[model samples]
Target: MSRTAAQFKLRMPAALRAQVEQAAKEARRSLNAEIVLRLEASFAQVKQEVSQ
Candidate 1:
């Protein structure tokens, strides 16, 4: 799907959280948007690799 909406709990190291938050701020995007964009890109990369 081109769009996604889901709610779930997530747990991660505090350091990782800080890194993501920092990147989000630098990109001028909300924390959630930054994470979603990255996750989508990661999946696309894996799919491409598998197809090759």
Candidate 2:
């Protein structure tokens, strides 16, 4: 299946932003990609909980 990507703005605390950026760099991924991956994982977890 093809997915349509949409741009959205997220506000993060400065400290949290720095942590996320550090993690992204360590993983060799762009910050945007890292955030998307994290969001997808969170959504999956929520869906699983809702289904149970």
Candidate 3:
């Protein structure tokens, strides 16, 4: 990924944010990276589901 990336503003529940923060810490990745990883996986999963 490029250092120069588009910025997005997201609003989520505090509980969800906390959960993601915990996961990010455990995984040793930044919160943005964790969120991007998850979102990319979701798109791949949806594509697979649609093709099935």
The lDDT per prediction is 0.90, 0.88, 0.96
Better of 2 and 3 by TM-score: 3
- Give the Å error, residue 25, model 1: 0.3
TM-score, predicted candidate 3 vs. hidden true structure: 0.89
Clashing residue pairs, backbone N/CA/C < 3 A, model 1 = none
Can you write out model 1's per-residue Cα lDDT over 1-52, one digit (the tens) per residue? 2346666788989999999999999999888888899999999999999999
Mind giving the per-residue lDDT tens digits that candidate 2 earns over 1-52? Answer: 1147666688989999999999999999989888888989999999999999
- Candidate that scores best on TM-score: 3
Question: Candidate 3: how many backbone clashes?
Answer: 0
Candidate 2 residue pairs in backbone clash: none
Model 3 residue runs over 4 Å out of place are: none
Which is the winner by lDDT between candidate 1 and candidate 3? 3
Candidate 3, poorest ten consecutive residues by summed lDDT: 1-10
lDDT per residue for candidate 3 within 4-48, as digits (tens), equals 898879999999999999999999999999999999999999999
**Model 3: per-residue Cα lDDT at residue 3:** 71
TM-score of each: 0.86, 0.77, 0.89
Model 1, position 13: C-alpha lDDT score: 97
Error of 3 at 14 (Å): 0.6
Candidate 3 residue 32 C-alpha distance from true site, Å: 0.2
